[model samples]
Target chain A: MQRIQWFKWLSLVLYGIPMLLVLVFPFIVMVSTSFKTLEEVSQIPPTFIPRNPTLENYREVWNIIPLADHFRNSFLLGVGETFLIMVLGVPAAYALARFRFAGRQPYLIFLLVTQMFPAIVVVLGVFRVVVALGLLNNLAVVATTAASFSLAFCIWLLVGYFSAIPPEIEEAAMMDGDSRLGAMIKMTLPLSWPGLVAVGVFAFMDGWNEFLFSLTFISNDEMMPLTVGLFRFISRFQIQWHHLMTGSLLATIVAVALFMTVQDKLTRGMLAISEK
Target chain B: MSVVVCKELVKRFGATVAVDHVNVEIQDGEFMVFVGPSGCGKTTTLRMIGGLETVTSGDIFIDGVRVNNLAPRHRDIAMVFQNYALYPHYKVFDNIAYPLRLRKRPKAEIEERVNTVARMLGVQHLLDRWPRQLSGGERQRVALGRAIVRNPKLYLMDEPLSNLDAKLRVQMRREIIHLQRNLGTTTIYVTHDQVEAMTMGDRIMVMRAGKVQQIGAPEVLYNHPANLFVAQFIGSPAMNAFKGRLETDDGKIVVATEFGRFPVGDPLVARLKPDRSPTLGAREVICGIRPEDITLDDAPVTPASPQAQVDLVEGLGADAYVSLTIGGTTLIARTPADCPPAENQLVTIHLNPNKLHLFDPITEETLLALP
Candidate 1:
């Protein structure tokens, strides 16, 4: 028993060391680079830690660009757009999962086909529409298109979660004097919160980090999200390395914090699906 | 007067008919059971009455009012699902009190009703726990409480005890029956188990292939099965059946079966009115009798008693199932436990009068219904 225990620890360490390095090493580099001076950042031999740690990059990135507006835009677009997708997606998924339609299987395949189009390619077509619709320089346009891009995958994940629940639960609710809609609200929706949260988190993250659409579609600086705002530190000649690194590091921390809050939900949702 | 009336109710899924024009009237406060094999549309019928499944082409009447277009909640019916269907998130109190809460009943009344039901089911202490925390039996009781709290006009149950172990199922069977008797609410229960059908239902409706084969009291079904389906489906261990020829010999009717040549009685002959079925006279007929109705005498006291070879004996507390072969056919006889014949032993068995049933092989219709 002692030998087995010892062997198990050996295996964990063997597997854990490289995985931790691959996962955590880049974040450490980003943080350390964000604090270093320009010369130190571009030094001949790269240092793992900043010898002369400073907060100048943080102060400059805030002042140089409309960084605060970009931050606000990212959140509004991320959370607001994600909320819209959920309101629309969960019901569509429920119908697809629970009810039968003439072209359901083919329609699902078609939704998946929509997911395969590259964001860059789709953004070009969307910009053409934006020009025709006179919606240029609109943050809403960026949020709407990004949400549309993420909608199909969101519905697909939710369909699995909804379909896993027995229809009997809803039927029971109805028999308990609830309307059909009420039954869904009271029974199916609550049971599927974890899956719904996972979808919300994904859409939010996609909206937050979205770059190509926000860069090309919204030419106005005030309307730019963080992903595009991060580019203001780069010019034709030289990149402001520390400001860019500091901006990215801040974004990463926010994403990490949000993910940490909902990682339990994500695990729970996946576990619910996998259970027989 | 009947409290529930389902008239020519039909449910068709695409080209397949799930319920083929069923008609049944349930008395006020009666416990009516629907019994059949799986996919025989018993659950579908109950679901239709509950308004979970839509009425494809028929009208349902509760208290003589047409409820075809009424929703489940509007119909004022409560249903206990086969899997309990208790909410995983809600505590037992909230789960049971949900119906009252939905109607916006006063706070104190909801609590009172929930408590009353909890105490009735002996789950008052567990009322604060979530459904997943309870055992299967506990979950089943909570499901019952949820249904009973509604005090609806009708109750529908879809094999609600099928999930429990055998011992618990028997115990719950009695609990439900007792509860239903006290409540005196009209109920329609669906089950595939003949024992539950016989024990719980005031009347049993035997169904096969989406059509109701028989609807009558349990004793009526056992004594006078409307058809072969009811004869075979209504009793435990099933009725012993054999292919045979019905012939008149020496002014007596006798069934010449591969199992044994047994004497058929006047009551069965009079019931068949055999002279009317000239085609049925020469054709093969099915002879059925309940297992308990067959008397075995290993040491024959009569010269005319038929002999059988016992192949197996399964002893229960009061009786043993003695599987025997007579001539070339096999049949199970319910024998006294103390006198179970040893395997492969020769024994003499006699059929009881007034209990013989005959069915036409081609049609499988009871001869009693022939004329």
Candidate 2:
């Protein structure tokens, strides 16, 4: 290899350092704050590295609220919401890809329009429905609203993937002695593993990161998920940024772990991987 | 004996009729080829028989049982698609054994059958490999193996060799014919290539615009086509067709056209006589002659022979096709390569009187063959 050039180093310093600061500096701050004392966090000429690191915030954040309970609630809601979204999304995607009906284009456009609305708009409408159902403090309202919002986009993503698979594959299965549904399950599903993984990850991450619906629909302390639980560190008098960073890092770790588990299934698309 | 029958079957997709009222009966152990150009309803008819397509009208009988509403699975048939739709997830062995497994056959039996087929197709070494790993010819054999392993009553091959290279297509064509004969399953093969139909089919069904033009043995179709469409469709370089008008002088029928004034033979005269109608005479006609039927001559050897200027000569190994301009028309004559006419050289082409086909210009129906 050629020796490294001075301009290359200069470009790397100019471009890469700024990118690292913009993309990675926040996580670094979050991490350093979580291990610092409240006094050290607000100190003028803030330290890049914690001068004195302590685990006191972790212990305090865990004890100040039901951290484990909030985590468990978030975990359960994410899993349930993702499962429900997939159950609704996969079949809808298959139908849109394979069949033609009079209102199909309009229906698809309507789903896209629904996705275009900001979460601020969705949170209030879902809150109204939750209140009307007498479920303001219930986690079910949060999970349901999260799944509904994610379902539309998940269906559209899967429609593109499902349409990529040729119908001849399923028809060949049918000729080989499977019913229509049997063909789909045996042939289409296995071939669609990538799409399924992507949609599942999308829905799960959507639910896990949602703050608006969880905040609006869940006010009870026990029913609140990690997203709403993060705000418990904030009071009218002062914002406990260290405890907030601790909870946020813990949530990020779990999300990363979930993604790691399903990463292999996400590698291949429907018909492309099978081609020589 | 395996058999399939389509009685007045018709299929329509919205306003476009993919297959018109079609009738076909495939006999036991017969290789029936559906030959046509693209959009000629050949594949649609095959799909209808395979039960992949629902019939818009009429009925289908499989082995003498009316199977109007039977699913493809229950019809006891296997189809080799044009793309060789191998299951991407399954290994070669499992792909071949899938149909047997679906029938709840014993695992041991399934393996034995798969092994036998793989060995027969010479794909035993690739049994554990995915379809993507195989060559084009190997994939075709695997597809053929999958179809034959079940020993179903009927086999439908939809342009199965169309995806391969020219040499491989010929090899696979022979393999399929050999495989089908050994299996003795009634087969209906669809193809747009007339050469494939001519070489492999025991009997070819020529189709055009969703209608059956003619159905017969290959030689019969070559010798006597029912209409102008079949005449133009069944040959490789296609038959040379020219416009002409029929006339009678001194009890002899003569054709007058741009090509030349040529006297009609006895077979054509009997077809034009008073039997079909007393008032029908002096009608517009289309005359056809196969490229091979015309032979080049150095001089006028016969009273009816005509001379023309050679424009192009295409040499194809053992034979040569000479293009000649007779007045304003170009005629292709299949001559032996040894004596092909040089460009700009004048030559006479003597057409066979017995092989002349005359068709009604308007209706396009062959006038010579219809009694």
Candidate 3:
């Protein structure tokens, strides 16, 4: 047993450390750059740690861009996107999983086909529609765009998740004096908590990090989400690398913190589908 | 009175008829069991009555009210599913109390009734436990408690004990029967096991190929099956069947079979009644006899007793089933365990004339009735 434990430790060190470094090295660089002086950020052969760490970058980043407004915009967009995705995707998924209807196969295939195209491929056409509708600079438009992109995947994942639970659970509830809708609310929804959490997390993350749609639709600096607002530090003349790194680091931390709260349920939901 | 009546009830799924013109009236407090092989529409019939499945045609009446369009909840029925269907997230107490809570009963009433049911099922200790923490038997008891708590007008169980082990099934079978007797609530249970149907039901309805084959009391179904299907299905190890011809030998009617010739008695012929006699002219027939009716005892051997070579012997604690073959025809005979004949031993076995059943080979309908 001791030899096996030693072998396990050796293999982890050999393979795990390099993979961790490859994934986390850029975040480390962001953290270092966020704390470094402006001059230290530009030094040749950049140091792994800042020689002189300062809070100046963090202080000046809010003043450089409307960081508070961008945070609010991102928060609103995430809430709106998550709400829309769940309200629309859950019933569609339940119907897909539970009911038999004409053209269900074709409709599911259509959802799959929609997922194949990246946002870049449809941005021009969407921009034209937005221009025609006079809906530019609208945060709701950005939220809706992001939600539409992830809705298909949300329904697809939940269909498998919901189908794994036996239908007899709901039938028993109905027999126990609940209506069909009530049975779904009391029995099916609670049983699907993990899958719903996973879907909600995905939608929130998509809205929080989306850039192409926000940049195209919201030209207003005050209305821009964090993803687009961070771009203000970049220009043709020069780049405010210190302030940009500081802002990006904060955004990453917020996203990571939100994810940490739901990762347990998210992994369980995904595992349930994969096991099936 | 909680009488449930189904008149020509039918359930058709697209191209296939799952239940065909089934008509049954369950009296108040009757424990009715539907028994059949798998895919025989027994479950479908129970589901239709429970309003889980819609009727393709026909009407269902509960307490003399037309309930064809009523929902399951509105119909006042409780069902125990085969897998127990306990809510995994709820504690046992909450699982049993949920139905009462749904009806918006007083909080005190819900609590009192849930506790009462928990005590009755002997699952009071498990009230705080989730379904996943309990054993299969405990889960089954919790499910029963949930169904019993509401005291609905009718109870429907879809093979509730099929998942239990043999010993647990028998124990649960007795508990359910005792519970039903005490409650005196109308119930319709569906199962494919004949033994369960015989033991639990006040009346058993047998189905095959989407049609009810026979419906009668346990002893009636056992002693006088309407057709070949019920005759073979109702008994364990099944009844021994032999293809033979009705022929007169020395002015006495006898069934000439491959095993041997057996004299047909006058009462059996009289029960055939001349106008209803389908085998008047020495026509081909199928004769059946219960294993217990064939004696393997070494008593005074009569002339007509057939000699069979014992091929196998299976001894139970008090009885043994001996597999015997005569002229390539196999017949199983039950004998006392202490007097099991040796394998390959030729034994003279007397088949009781009163217990012999005759069936028309072409129609597969019983030609002889119980006297």
| Highest lDDT scorer | 3
Report the lDDT tens digits of candidate 3 across residue range B259-363.
688877778877874654644577788999889989875543776667888999999979999999988889998888997999998888778877888888988
The segments of candidate 3 whose C-alpha lies over 4 angstroms from its true place after superposition are: A37-39, A259-276, B273-280, B297-305, B369-371
Writing each residue's lDDT as its tens digit, candidate 2 over B77-169 gives 898998889988888998899989999999999999999999989999999999888887888888888888888888899999999999989
Q: What C-alpha RMSD separates each model from the true structure? A: 2.8, 2.6, 2.8
Cα lDDT of model 3 by residue, A1-276, tens digit:
999999999988999888899999999999999998878888898887889889999889978889999988998899999999999999999999888778999999999999999989999999999999999999999999989999999999999888988889999999999898998888888788777887887888888888999999999989999989998888899888898999999998887887788687678765653432
List of clashing residue pairs for candidate 1: none
lDDT of 1 by residue, B141-178 (tens): 99999999868888899999999999999999999999
- Candidate 2 local lDDT, A1-276, one digit each (tens): 234687788888999899888999899999989998888989999987899899998899888889888888888788888889878888898999988778999999999999887778656666677788898877767788788878898999999988987888888888889998898888877787777877877777777777888887777888888988998788899988889999899888887987777665466454555453
**What DockQ do the predictions score, one after another?**
0.59, 0.59, 0.52
In model 2, the number of clashes is 0
Model 1 docking grade: medium
| Residue A188 miss distance in model 1 (angstroms) | 1.6
At residue B315, candidate 2 shows an lDDT of 97
